[model samples]
Target: MGSRRQFIKTVSASGAGLVAASAMGVMQEASAHPTSVWGGDIYSGPHEMVKNSKILSIKNPDGTETLGVVTPKGVIDVRAVAKKMKISAPLTLDQLLQEGNAAGFNKVVASADKSGVPYLDESKITYGRLFKNPGKIICVGLNYRQHADEVGMARPAVPPLFNKYNNSLAAHNCVLEIPPPEISYKLDYETELLIVVGKRMRNVPEAEALNYVAGYCTSNDFSSRDLQLELPSGQWMIGKTLDQYAPIGPYFVTSDLVGDPNNLKIQTWVNGEMRQNSNTSDFIHNTQHMLSYISKYWALEPGDIVFTGTPQGVILGMPKDKQVWLKKGDKVVSYVEKLGELKFTLG
Candidate 1:
C-alpha cells in the first residue's frame, strides 16, 4: 500500500475528482454503496453518520480487524453476523464510513440485535485500532485556556494546527515502546477530546460543524517534550508522531449520544493518581470554532480525525524542581465523558 504522503501526492498530481471517482468505484465493488455520496452535500447541509451506537474494531487471530456493534446482549461481530444471515455489510468501521456504507452497517446491527444471534463478550475480545487509516490526523495546539496558562504561552488569535501520521495510531490496552533515553525521555500524557468527521466539510459554518462529525472517542496525545520543544526550532510533528504514540478507543460513541461535544469532562491518570482534571468547557476555541476555522483552509473528509487539544496538568506545566517525567512500565488512562476509558502501558 502507498504511504499517505504518496497518496496525497497522487491526489495533487491528479485532480481530486478523478481520484475520488476511482476510489468510489473500488468501494462500490466491495460494499453496498454504489455512489460516493454518504451524508448530505454542502448545499443540502450536514448530517451525523451514525446514531445511538457504540462501534468497536475487533482484532482477529489472523491479523485482520472486523467491525463490531455494542448491543445490550453483547458486541455483535458485524462480519460474522452478516455472513450467517447472508446480508451485505461493511466488514470494517473504516469501510463503513469511508465507503458510504452506513445504511448497510446499520441494517446489520439492527438485524443482529433482533435475530437472536450470538455475540461475543467485549471484555474477552482483543481490540484493534478504531481508525486504521484516516486521510488526515489534524491536531489543535493550546486550545485549552488552562493549558495555555500553565505553559506560560499567550493564547493564539487563531487555533494552532499540527498533524500526526497514521504510524502513530495505536489501539486501547496496547503497549507503547518508548524511544531510547538518548533520543529524549521527557514523555508526557495528554488527554483530549477526539472528533471523527463523517461528512465532507469546506468552509462549514460553526453552527453546522457538529453535523459533520461521525462520533467522538477517548484519545491521548502522547508527547516527547524534549524533541517537541527543546529542538532548534521545535519539531512538533516529530515529537507527537512516534510509533504507537497516539492510542485511541475502547469505543467510538456516536455524535447524537455524546450531545454537546464542547461541554464534556476530560481527564488523565498516571497509574492510579489523577494528573489532569478538566472539562472541554475550558476550550479557548471550542469544537465548533476549531472545525469551522480548519474547514476554511482545508477540506475535512470522511474518516478524518481531529484532536481537540489537551487541558492543563501536564508535566511541562509543573515547575522545574518538581518535574518528574514519565518512565517505562507506567500506565496511562485517558477518559472523556460519554467516551470510554482508554488505557495503555509504556514498555
Candidate 2:
C-alpha cells in the first residue's frame, strides 16, 4: 500500500496543475419535470463549497465522520441513526443512493448535526457513493478521441467498454497497488469522469439516455500498460481491471445538478508529477452518444457505473525513452474538476 505522503504528493501535483474534469440508455421518455429526483433543488459545484446545506451524520451528526448532501427541506442526513440497532457508525456510499424514505436516514443526520462533527470542519457534506453496493462495475476504454490518438489507435466509432470487479472501487485515502515488480511494470494513472445509473433502461435513444443517471464521481482507470499490451491481439479488457484498476469516489453528484456531462475538466498526477491534463470537452464520443450506443446492446441498471475514458499523457503515449512505470509505494491521483479526487497507493 502507498503511504499517505506519496498519495498526497501525487494528488496535489495533478489536482493543482489544472482544473480537472456519462450515461446511458433508454427507450423511455423523461418528463419535462423530474420532481421526484433526490436533491432536485441542489446546485452543482465542488462539495466543500455547498455541502453544508446537505444532511449527513444526522443521528450522531456531531459524532462520526460522514458526507452531507443538500436537500430541498435543507439537508438530508445520510449517517443518521437507522431503525435497526447494531449498525455501523458511518454509512457506506451505496446506502445513501438506494431509493426509499430518507426519513430515517435524515433523522440521524439532523440529530447528529444538532451537536459535534469532524469529517469536514464545516458540518455540510456531499455524497460519495449513494451507498456501498455489491454489483458489477463497467468501464469504457479509449472512449476519448484525443486519448486514442495519443495511444496510437484509430478512433473507435462505438464506446470501447470493459469490466472491473468491485475490488477496483477506491474512495479517498485509498492506496493503489503497483504491479508486481518482476515483470512489465508500467502501471499508469488515468483521469476519468464517471456516472452511476439510477434507473434501469434498455435500448434507450441517445437523446434520452442521460435521464437514467443518478450522479457523477471521479475515477482513476489505473492500468499496467505493459501487461495490458503484452498480448498483441489488442483485446483491451485484460489490462483494464488490475487490482485497484479503478479508483472511484470523493462523492456522487446527481445528474439533475450536473448540467452538462461533457464539459468538465479531467486531470491526473503520478508521484507529484503532472502527467495527464485535459477536459471532458475532448471526448470523441460524448456521453449522449455513448448512452445511446450502449443501450442498443445492454440494459443499464441502477448502481451500474460508467467511467468515461481518460485523456492524453498516459505512459503508453509517452516517448519510451522517458517512460517510467509506477513502482511500489507510488501515488496516483485522478481528479475531475467538479467531482473531486480519487487517490490510491501502488504498494
Candidate 3:
C-alpha cells in the first residue's frame, strides 16, 4: 500500500488506490453472502441454517452442548429433534472431526428439515449479540483506495489498523443516540466485512490464516469524522469510540461454508438509497495477509473479529459540495454475504 499522506496525493478524482496495489495476484473472489452476484451459482439456494435463524441455549439429557436455532415460524429444538432420531448438536468442528458429533449434527439437521416452521421474514426478527465474541475487535482503515481519498489520507505501507471497544456494539434494530450535541458534526457510516475467529491461534502464518477464521458477518464501523479528525495526532479511537458506533451482524455463518472471504460484495444503505457499494476484492490488503501480520503481536482466539475494511462510497467519499452527514431518523444497513443485513435506526 502507499503512505496515508502520500496516497491521496497520487490519485486525482478517480482514485488510484485500487489499481496502485495488487497483493492477491488474481484477487480471491467470494461474496460475503451466497446471494451476491459476484459468484453466480455458488450458494446451495436458501438453506435452513441461515435466513430467519436465531441461536439459543438449550439443555437435554446428555448434559449440555444443547443449542437451538429459531427459524421464521418457530424454534427447531436441534437436540430434541436429534435425540428423537439418534443425533447430536456439534459444539465444535472437532465434533465433526471426531465423527460422532458430525453424525449427530447431520441427524439434527435432517430432523430440522422435516419441521413445519415457515420461512422467516428477516425484517421481523429481533437481533441479538450476533456473535458473543470474548475476543479483541480489530479493524483496518483506508484499506480501500476510495476511502483514503475522501479523507485525504495517503495509503499505508501496510494495513492501516485500529481497534474499537466491545462497549460500542449495537445490534440490527437498536437506535444510536446522535453523539451528544457538544461533539461532532460529521457522523458517518462504514460498511465492512467482519471475520470471526473460529479457533485459538498465535504466530499464525498467512498461508494458514483462513483456518483460524470461524466465519464472516457484517458491521457498520460508524464514525464521527469531525471527532475522528479532531486531534492533530490523529488518534482514531477518540472518534471511533463515542458510544454506539459499531453496529454488526444478523447471523454468524460458519466460515468453512463461506469459501473465500476476500471476494465478497460489501454494501451500505442509508435510509432506502444505496450509498456504499464495492467488493472485498478491492481491499488493498486482503484478509490472509492481515491475519498473518496481526498474529505476530496478538494471539487471536475463537471469538476475535477482524473487520477487513470498508469499500468506497462513504459520506466522506462525496465531494465537499455533496456531503450530508447522518442524523436522527436515519436507517443504515450494512450487509455481507451469508451474514445477512444488519439494520439500525438512529434517533
Candidate 4:
C-alpha cells in the first residue's frame, strides 16, 4: 500500500466523472440497502480494502453517529459522500470491519470531487468510540520488560491476560464520568497500543500473525488501583474494568499505514505533566506473539480488540510515597507514532 499522501494524490488526479461513472456501475450489482444504519452496530459484509486510509466515527447531534475517512484535506464524511454520489457504503467502522466493504468506501471517496464534497475540520466534530460492542475486549498485563522491572517484578514466562466489558470503551476527546469518590479513589492512567483484529482465526502461528490485524490505535487502560490491588484475590478486573476505563482512538489507522506496530514510540501525559514515556520496543511479548498466543485458545474475530500492555512510568510503578492518582478535572492524553493522540478528560 502507498503512503496517505500518495493515496490522496491518486484520488485527486483521477477525475470524479470517471471514478463516479465506474463506481455507479459497481454499486448497481451490489446487494440491497438495509432498512436503516445503526450507530456502532455490526454489519455482515466481510473486511475489504479501501485506500491506505485512517477510519473514525463522528457524533451527530441527534445521538446517532456516522463514519468518516481521514483524507489529506480533512475528514470526509463517508455517509454524506455516499449519499450525494449515490453509492453503496458502510455507515460504521464495525460495519466496514464486519462487511469488508473498503472497496465500496474507496469508490465513494474516489468519486468525490475534491471541491464538491464538504469535509469537516477534525476539531469541530465530536469523536465517537473507534469501535463499539466488539466481541471481546482482551488485555495484557505486565508485558513490557521495563515496566516489569520498574514495578519490582520478574518477567513472566507467559502473558497475563484479562478482559474488559463494553462499558469501558470511550472516544478520544470525550469526558469520562469517573466513578464516585467513595467507590475507589486510586484512579490511574496506563498508556498502551491497541490492536484490532481484522478477521476470524484460530491456532494461528507467530510466523504470520500480523496478517490477521485490521489496524492499530492508541488507548488508555484507565484503572482504579484501589479496587484492583486492595481486594483479596488481586481483583485485576475490578480495578481495571470500570466504565470508560478503556478510552481509545482519535483515529484507527489501517495496518498498511502502520507497518511496524512493535517499534512505535508510546507516551502518556496527565494535565500538562509528562507521566509515562516509552516505546513498544520494550514490550516483552510483541504484537505478533500476543495475537498468536491468544489465538491458540480463542478465535479472534473482526472488531475484537487486544490492549497490548503499557510501558513503565505508570503511577503504579512509582515509589509508594511519590504516587498520585488521577482526579476529576484531569486531562489524560496518550500518543503512538502514527496513531494520533487519544485525549480525554476525567469527571
Q: Compared with the true structure, what per-residue lDDT tens digits does model 3 show for residues 271-332?
A: 89999888888877889888888888878765678877788888877888899999889999
Better of 3 and 4 by lDDT: 4
lDDT score, candidate 4, position 113: 67
Task: Note the residue pairs that clash in candidate 4.
Answer: 45-98, 45-99, 46-99, 46-100, 47-100, 48-100
Q: Flag the better candidate by TM-score, 2 or 4.
A: 4
Question: Ten residues in a row with the worst lDDT in model 1?
Answer: 38-47
Worst 10 residues of 4 by lDDT: 33-42
Quote model 4's TM-score.
Answer: 0.86
Kindly list the per-residue Cα lDDT of model 1 for residues 1-347, writing each as its tens digit.
46988998987878977889999888887566333332222112123376788998999999988888988889999878777776666777666666656666778887886666788999899999998888999999998999999999999889999999999999999999999999979999999899999989999999999889989999999999999999999999989999998999988899989999989999899999999999999999999999999999999998899998999999999999998899999999999999989999999
lDDT of 2 by residue, 1-347 (tens): 57888999998988765543201122122334333233332213221111122222222334433445544445434443332332222353443444423343444555554333323432344223233343557777787777788778999877877777766655554556555666547677778888777567688888888877767778777777766777687545667776556767665665666669999988888788888889899998888787777777888766677878889998888888988767878877778876766666676
**How does candidate 1 fare on TM-score?**
0.86
Q: After superposition, how far is residue 49 of candidate 3 from its true place, in Å?
A: 15
How large an RMSD does model 4 have? 15.4
Collision pairs in model 1 = none
TM-score of 3: 0.69
When sorted by lDDT, best at the front, the candidate numbers are 1, 4, 3, 2
